[model samples]
Every structure is written in C-alpha cells, then in structure tokens.
Target chain A: MVIMRRVAAGLLVMLLSMMARAELVVEVTQGVEAPTAIAVVPFGNETGSALSEDVAAIVQQDLQRSGFFQPMARENMLGFPVQQSELYYRDWRIAKMDYVVIGRAVSVGANDISVRFELYDVLREQSLLSEQVTITRDNLRDGAHFIADRLFERLTGLQGAFSTRIVYVTAEQLAPGKQRFRLQLADWDGARARTILESSEPIMSPVWSMDGSKLAYVSFETGKPAIYVQYLATGRRERIQSFPGLNGAPAWSPDGSQLALVLSRDGNPEIYILDLQSRQLQRVTRHYGIDTEPSWAPDGQSLIFTSDRGGQPQIYRLELANRKLERLTFEGNYNSSGRLTQDGRFLAMVHRSGGGGNGFDVAVQDLKTGRLDVLTRSGMVESPSIAPNGSVVIYATQEGTRGVLAAVSLDGRVQFRMPAVSGDVREPAWSPYLR
Target chain B: MEIRSYIVPFVLALGVHAAVLALLSTHWMGHDEPQRKVPRHIEAQMIDLTALARREAEQAHIAEERAREAEQAQQAERKRQERVAAEQRRQELAKQQAEAETKRKARQEAEKKRQKEQAAQRAAEQKRQAELEAKRKAEAVERKRKAEEQARRQEAEVKRKAEAAAKAAKERERKQAQAEAELKQALAREQKAREAAARQASQAVIGDIQSYIQAMLQNGWRIPSTARNGMEAVVTIHLLPNGEVDQAYIHTSSGNAAFDNSAIQAVYRVQRFPRVADIDPILFERRLRKLSVKFRPEGLRW
Candidate 1:
C-alpha cells in the first residue's frame, strides 16, 4: 500500500509538471512589453529551378500573422543577402529590425525539394536556429509555415498556429445590377483556397472568433444584409443581427462577450454595442450623419469608430463611460475605416486624397510622433485590420478580376495579396494574437 | 505530502525565474560598461555580415591613442625619405657644375694662344715695303686681312662667349621655367590637397550633424526607467502637415506624474523626429493630423 502511494505520487508529479509547463502557454495573457521587430526579406530561389510557392513571402505572412513579429517590408529592406554570410546587420539595424530571416530552396528531384531557412537575432547578432527540412512539392507551403512557427516560438516565446487559415468574402459583378458573391477561406499565405459560401447577393466582413474555430460575418442571403456567426467545423450558422433598415459592420468584441455594430433601427446609422449573452443592445453613439465601422480598442474602455458627424466619414471616439462621443479625426478631409493599434497609441486609417476621389491611401498616425505615414500607395484598400503587434494590416481590395485580401505594414514597408483559387475573396480581419 | 513534493520544483523554477527577472530588471551597476569589446561602430557594422558580426564580438579592441600613433608614424617615415633624397640630388648637381666651369676656363686660355701665333708673320713687314708701289694692292690686302681677322676674332668671341652667355641665359631661363612650374605644381598640389581636405572635413561635419540629431532624438525619447507596469494613459496629439506636432494633450492619465511628463516630453524632445519633411503637408494633415497614444506598463494583453 505504501509502495502504491509512492508510485501514484510520482505519476501525479509528472502530470502536474506537464500542466504547469503549459501554464505559460495559456494564451499569453500578458504580451511582451515591446513588440518584437522582424525583417522578412524576399525568399531566394534555388539554383536549379523555380518554385511555385514564394516561400519567403509565405514565411513573412506566417510570421506577420502571429502578431508577435513586426514584419519589415521587402521594399524597406536596404539589403537582403541570401546566404547568412552575405547578410549585413547594419542594414537591418538601420531599419530597426530585431530579427532577420533568410531562406532558399534546393531542388532535390523533379518533384521533390529541400527548403532551408534560418532566423537571426539582429540585436543579439546570432542565428536563433538553423531549421532545415525537405518536403515534396505538395507540402512546400506547409514547410514554409513550419519555419515560421519555429521562428515565432523562439522569438515571441509562443507557439504559432499560422500554418492554419484565413476566411473572407469575395464579390464580383455578374451583370449591370446583379452581382455574385462567395465566402472563402485559404491557407494563411493565400494558397490552397476553397470557397465556403456562394451567392448572387453581397457577402462582406468575415471575422474569426477568439479561437479560429468560429466566424461572424455579414451575409445578404435573406433579401437583406444580416450578421451571422458560423461554426466552421459543423457548418452550423446562426443569424446574430437582423433588422429592417441598415444591418452591417459586425465586429466581435475582444473578450468574445459582445459585438459592436452599426444599425439604422434607431433612425440613423449609429453604433450599437450588442450584448452577446443577454442579446441586449446598448447604443454607443448617436449622431446625425452616418456613424459606422466600429472597432474595439485593446482595452474595452472606449471604441474607435467612423462617423461623419463632424461632416464627412471620419473616425470618432466614443467613451463607454458616460457614453461621451468625441471627433477623433480632423486632419483628413475624408478619412474612414479607423483601426487602433493594440497599445491604442497609433490609429491606422484610410486617407482619401485628390479632388472627387482620384487617389486614396492607407495611412498610419503615430500618436506620439503626431507623424502620419502613408502605408499603402495602392488606391484600393478597405476594412484594414491591424495585427496584434500593430505591425501589419490585412484588408480587402480589387486584385485583377477578384476581390482579394491584401496586407500592408503599418510602417509602410511590406505589401501582400492573398487571392483564393475559387471566386473573389475580400474583407480580411486578422485574429487577435492566438495562444 | 503530495503538495510538499510538488512545491519544491515549482518553487525552484519560480525562484530562478524571479531571480533572473529581478536581475534583468534591477539594472546591474557595473555591467553597463562593455569592456574588452569591439568599437560600437564595428559592432553596428558586424550585424550585416554573419561572420564579421561574430568576429566583432570576439576581438579585443586596440586603444584609440595607440592606433593613431601607428598611423602618424607611417606618415612621418614617408616624408623623411622624400625630403632626404631631394636634398642629396641638389648637392650632387651643384658639385658637377663647379668642376665643369673650371675645365671650360682652362680650354678658353689655350685657344687664345693659338690665334696669337697665326697672326705674327704679317705684322711688321707690311708697314714700309709696300708704301707706294703696292699701295693699292697693300691697302686692299690689309683691308681684306683686317676684315678677315676681325671676322675670325668676332666669330670666335661670339661662339665661345655666346656659349657662356647662352649657358647663363639658359640657366636663368631654366631657373625661371622651373620656378613657374614649381609654383604651378605647388598650387595644383595645394588645390588638390585642399579639396581632399575639404571633402574629408565636410564628411566629418555631416557625421557630427547626424550625431547631433541622434543626440537630440535619444535625449528627447525620455522614457522613464521607473515606469511601473499596468500604466495606462491616453495622449491626444495634434499635428501640422509635414508630420510635425502642433500640440499634444494628456487626454488620459497614467497615474504617475513623472511618467506622464516623460511621455509628453518625449514627443517634445523628438524636436521633429519621424521627420517627414518631404511628404506633402496636405497628405500629412489629412492622414496623420490627430491621434491618440496609450502606454501600458505591464504587457498590454490580458
């Protein structure tokens, strides 16, 4: 009986230790004080042949998705040497890159290849790891993600699950008045795309729940646009918001407790904070002009929202306390789609330029510098969602014939397009930093 | 008993982590100086080249004074040899010219003696013998001889004296030509040297200007070391186009007076950092005109 107790105690000890190690893994409740800086240069090709997956770019997307590594754009890369020996640390340091990654692929066979990669700590001036692996052509995308996962773990001290997916909406014109729409999800780097929903009506604003398991999006299936939360695993969906007038822009609150959206049942389109538990709605903003596109700040105290109350669709801030509303955007004649940084120090928004809509760009305003940086010179960008690290944002835009998801770094260095294989994909919302 | 056994390892890990965190956060006093290390510039450069960056961490740095001394010593050696060789060549040319002048004077005296012997035969007889009979012929011959002798003497004197005079003239001309060439060369060398020196000086000045900007930025950043975690503040900053701060407000308080002041001062201290002077003022105003800044002392996520 005494021996049995001892054995049981050892077993219990083993189990508890396992669980305790996972305690730090509990969704990283406390993020790093200073967000890491990562420089993701363009992936180099192997000497023998060309590769289908731009592995470097995919790796960049995977790292950027984690919201731990702030990816520096290839355009901003002063110098990118393929081999570790050729890497010039000064160039990266000048760009304030904390870590720099270089990679290349070698064709082992007609259908097989060995991809090689390394992550270097620019400040520490050391290669964090030399993780090299070989894979078939079918698994090249997985291989790129695997490298990203390893780097993410070493730097952010958290495991990265970006080898997963992205679900979004794509729209197209079928005829003069009729339009075709499709709901789609793809690999994190925009490969292996498949359609989830297809319709003639418009589908927009696809958002992922805290866990990447569920989605809440705006679908116009029932003759009018209504908000629906769908479970990806069981293909189960429940309409969360449906009203007579305008029912649009449904964004899930950070805690998954409530949703902040825009509705016209109150006569004008003002922001209404909906309680997910009680199904009770509280009006957050009351304005004459259009008040829409509400996004939650890191702390749930206040929400940064878009309103034209001061004239034009500009961003406005509403303090949940006393429900006081203040105009947040006054610099731009036309600014919309305001997304706050996780720290709430920076406001990333779309700035409209030129007379009568000739030019538009995505801009970032450092609240500290009072400095505005135009992140996207590209004309088409909508629904820009900043990553948890405030480094990059993914938004909806027209790419060729389809509406695809593209990302722009807040610092204006990196740009990427995620186009699905079937139908058009748009309105990409990056998930909060996943555990 | 079960809890007791679990407590040891748990406590040990926690203690080690806490100790390390404390050590890191405490700002250990003496470790601030990275001695026996490479220069900061070299350290900064090494990041680019993997091997070199690694090398920078390994090598012990030579003192600045010793390196400067070695460079100055090399320059001194080069100047010493060039000056000594120039002085030796000047002395050798002067000695050779003195020996040649002595030889030329002795040769001129011997030539005058040979001309005197040749003119002695016709000297006395031509005065009385041909007083009247050959007066015409004598006068003609005497005139022709005198003319020929005069021409010979003039030719000899002109050739030999011309050689001496021309040599003097050539020497003077050579000296004048050399002086002009030396003056031009000196001016050209000086001009080239001045330009090179100017280029170097300007480069240093540019570097100083950049360092001054860096100093201003570094001093301006001013994040207080004592800022505790869970620090939350809302700062609203207004901007002018061209990315300059027009005005800033501490819209939300972080609780700590010093921290809040530091945050406000950092923007002011920037003095014009994130300098986007080249961007269109209109675009800067439109996009980045007004913004809010928040800081969390404890990590932001929960």
Candidate 2:
C-alpha cells in the first residue's frame, strides 16, 4: 500500500506538472452585471418575398440568451437601417445600444437567398463586421446563429457557445402501465430536436464524452441496468458494461482513454476504472459500504465517487495509481452524485439539507475552501452538469411533478428554465466546446 | 514888689538931687559974690546954733536933732549908697553866679542825657550781642538734635530695608522654583497631548483616505455580467502624488475576462484619486501608495 501510494503521488506530480498553469476560477452566478447593449434591426427584404423567419429576431434571441448581451426590443428601435447610407448612428446611440446589426436578405432564386449583414459599433461609429452568405429558406436560422456567434466572439473576446448542441432524455407516459423514453439531441435553444433512440425502458445518467461526438448512459432494457456507449452521428451503440448486480453511472475520462463506473459484481457496489484501450477493469474502492457513481477529475489523475463507508453517502477522491482514497465532502450527511467542474475548482452534487427533508437539491462546493452552498431551494433536484465555460450548471428538476431542465449560474445568481418539451425531460448533458 | 517900689523912689531922689546941685552951682557962679554969702550964713548958724540948738535943741534939739537928723540922714544916705553899690555888686555877683550855675547845670544835664543815651546804646549793643550768642547756641543745639534724629532714622531705615530685601529674596526664590516645576510638568503634559493628537489625526487621515478610495471605486466600477455575486478581482494600482493613475493591472483575475476587465476599467475610470494624494507622503507610501483592492460584485445577484 505504501509503494502504491508513492506511485500515485508520482503520477499526480507528473500529471500536474504536465497540465497548464490553472488560473483562479471564481464562480460567477450573476449574469453580466452590465449586459452590453445591442440592437438587431430587422433586415430589409429587397427580394420582395415574404420572409418565413425573422433572421434579425433569431440573432437577437441568440445573443440575449447568452446572458452577456441586452438586445433592444423591436419596438424600442428608432429606425431600421438595411444599407450603410440609412444607418443613423445617433438613433442607435439614443436607444442606448452600443452596437447595431443591419442586413438585407435578397432572394436569389426560389430556394436560395443572399443574406448580407453589417455590424455597426454605434459608440465608435464604425463598421465592425460585414459579411455576405447564401442560404436556402431553411438555413436562415442557421445563418442568423452564425451572425450571433461572430458578434458575440467579437465583443466579448471569448468563443461563442450559441451554436452548440445539448442531448437529454425525455419520458412520455403513453398508456396506463407503459412509459416511453427518448434520448433526444437538440440545438442549444431546444430548437431542431432529433431523437436518436426510443425505448420503453427507463434511461438515466446520460453523459457526453469530452469530444461531444458520443454519449454513454444506462438503460433498464435487458431486465437489468446496463451501460451503453452510443455514437451520436452514426446512431451506432454497443453495451459496454453489464454486470451481475448493478452496472450504471458511466463517466468518461478527460482524454477518453478510460471510463469510471460503479459495478456490484463482487456482491457489493464499488467503483471501477476501466481502461478503454485494454478493456481492463481496475477496482478503485475497497469499502464494504456502498460505493457508486464514479466521475473522473479534469486531469484524469484521480476519480471522485460516492461512498457510505463513514456513514451516509459522501463523496471521496481516489487516486488512480495508488488507490488512495480521501473524503472530499463533510458538509452534509447525504452528499452524492459529485460532478467536477471543467476547471476542477468546484463540485456540483445532490445535497440533502441538514433539516431532514424528504428530497435532495442541487448544491455546489468549493474544493479548495471546503465551503458548500445549496444552490437550489426547490427539492428533488439531480443530474447537475456544468457548461463548457464552467459559468453555469444545468440540472434536472421537478416542477409540480413535471421533470424540467433548469440552468443556474455557478454563483447561483442567474437562473432560467428551458422551454418545456412534449414530455418530462431529465438528465441533461451539456456538450463540450464545439469545433 | 520891694524892688519895683525902690526903682521909682530912687529915680525921684536922683532927679531932686541933680536939680539941687544945678541950682546951687548956678547961683554961686552968678553971684560970685554970693561966695561971701556963705560966710554970712555961717555967722547965723552960730546964733541959731544956740537957738537953733535950743530950738534946734528943740529945733536945735530940733536943729540938733535936725542936724542930728541931717547928720543921721546923711549918714543914712551914705549908708544907703554904700548899701546900694554893695547890693548892686552883690546882685551882679549873684546874677553872674546864677548864670554860671544855670549854664553849668544845663551843661551837666546835657552831659547826663548824652551819657544816658550812650549807656542805653551800649546796653542795646550788649543785649543784641547776647541775643545773637543765645540764638547761635540754640541753633547749634537744634542742628545737633536734627542731625542725631536724621542719623537714627537712617539707621532704622537701612535695617528695615535689609530685612525686607531678605524676605523678598526668599519669597521670589520659592516662587521661581514653583514656577519652574509647574512649567516642567506642563511641558511634559503638553508634549504627551501633542503626540496623542498627532496619532489620532494621522489615524483619521488614514480612515479618510480609505473611505475616499472606496467611494471613488464604487462610483467608477461598472461590474460586468460575467462577475458573479462573490467573484473578486485583486488589482494592484500605482498612482502619482497628484492622484493620477499611473498603472493599474490585475494581480489576480477572477478567471472571467469580462469581470477582470470591468475591475481594470473601474480603476481607469477614476483616472486619479485625489484623496490618497491628500494623505501624508510617508503614510501613503507605507500603506496606500501601491494599494491592492478586492472588488466583489456582491449586490449584482439577480
């Protein structure tokens, strides 16, 4: 055990040394304290055909949803300027808009349109971006999203995640005794949803790999819980883990070289680290008390899992090489489902309040300070997933018995809910930064 | 009265006798021959002598008596003339003697009056000299008395003044010592109070400077949306004495670009902090010149 611990220390030293120097990550929950003002004027239709989608409105919504921009409402716009000659910068300045976007959508053919947009820096009174792209009628939304992404990146000096996708599981009650579960993938705004799988069995714990091209989850289809990895683009899937007692809680390692999972094959639930290349399983926990729900740390040097060894289920960190386990959480009696943030600075988990409530709520804790914060007052919350920027956390919550996905910024200041779909949605998995 | 009666009788007798002599001389000369008449009368006289003697005795006696009377009268007249001459001489002598006596008495009285005036003058001179001597003696005594009195008074005054001077010196020395002691104590107390006041004043200045900086930053900061409720950015800012921002950069970012930029922008917006410039240079350099402020947008939570 001592030699193994030494190896683990060496591994940690090597891994930490190889990693880039991490900047201090301060959790910000409050949306932009001063959201930048922007004006998205409706584009002039020179083609004279009735436009199906309001491209400017779509772009305005995209920027507004990011919480970093405050888009002026259409009624608030003083003038609609499509051409450079008609752009009265003083009008936008009077409207308190820092930037303005104007464009004209010209229908080139029956199926194609030429969309040209010019972004104006109203404060500086200069054109920031001018671009023209051809698209079909259905591609107008996509084109608008592209414009919003460009504007966001230019103004905030950070890459825009507006064009990203999110996959979630939804369950619909069909008959008196039957329920249908669908694994759905959709745009960031829940638009353009496409189902990848549908089954009557329950689906739980859907997680995306680091590349955002594959998803791993557990399904109760074979009369037992099994972990399956599915290729998102090809609809190809394979059952990766199916043990004697329990096979669930699949988490991908940072490099996609391994998966940390919980297995009960040895008569008790324990965490196991499976090497993806060698198909080798390594037991990471030896506690007789139940150990489950293993998640990989960002550096992949360790894994955090839930265990009931000391008493109630609490989170523990296990160094992979030496199998050294350390208790990470002591704030509450029941702290489980630990999910590490992208920066490895915080852990979002299912925490039960000390007042002995019947349900658990989403909570986050600073790993360095041992400070815990209960983020949600509403009970019965679970599946907390951090966004790619580590600024927000999306979780599955119940609102009057209807499961809905809600997102809260890490500091718990900004909270919003996704539009309700056709059925109850849960287990939301935010995609990584897209290429 | 006898002298006046004699003067008239003598004048008459002389006149009669002169007349008789003239007549007799005239008659004799005229009658040179009458010389012979006397012889004739002589013869008658003898006859009558007896008759005359008898008559004379009566007459003679008368004559005799007459003769005797005549003889007696002649003798009486001679006696009277002698008496008169003698009386004249005696009267002359008596008059001369009386004149001489009166002259002598007058001279004697004049001499006496002169002698009395001389004596009186001599007595007045003596009295005046004596009075002068007495007055000189009295003046000497008075001068001596006054001198003695003045000397006594001077001695007493000198002794009294010496004692008063000694007492005054002692009192002045004691007062001077007390005053020096009080002044020393007062100086010490004043020094202590001054030090305490300086300390309190400097502390107040420090507080004011801090409050000014905080207020300026509050007005200057525009917290970005990326700043969370608890997000903090520690920015080190360098400033000039005139309250101008010389340099401001993040010592530690809150890992949010917008948040860090917002903090930096706040520092830039203030441009200068005149409050810090108002503080003491030494204290400012020690505590406030290069200050690091932690900005937390705690109120920004929705």
A146-185 in candidate 1: lDDT tens per residue?
A: 7887776665444455565666776777688977787777
Residue-by-residue lDDT tens digits, candidate 1, B1-302 = 34346546856975896688568644642343352132222111111336543543343133223435665775555355335534543453354344444444444443344334323323323332344337547646765775576576557656757877798899999999999799767855775575467446644543443344334433443333224456665566665655466775687787765455445544453535354454334323333355555544443221
DockQ of each: 0.01, 0.05
Instruction: Name the runs in model 2 displaced over 4 angstroms.
Output: A1-38, A43-51, A82-136, B1-220, B228-256, B260-302
How far does residue A163 in candidate 1 sit from its true spot (Å)? 4.5
lDDT of 2 by residue, B1-302 (tens): 33346656656975896689668757744643443343221111111223322431232133334445568667876567557745864685577567656766765665676667556655755665565466556656665665565555555555656666777787898898789778657754765575467557766876677677777877766665555566777888877877788877898887777677667666766667876677766455555557777777765432
Q: Identify the leading candidate in terms of lDDT.
A: 2
Residue A260 lDDT (model 2): 81
lDDT of each: 0.65, 0.75
> In DockQ terms, which candidate is top?
2
| Highest TM-score scorer | 2
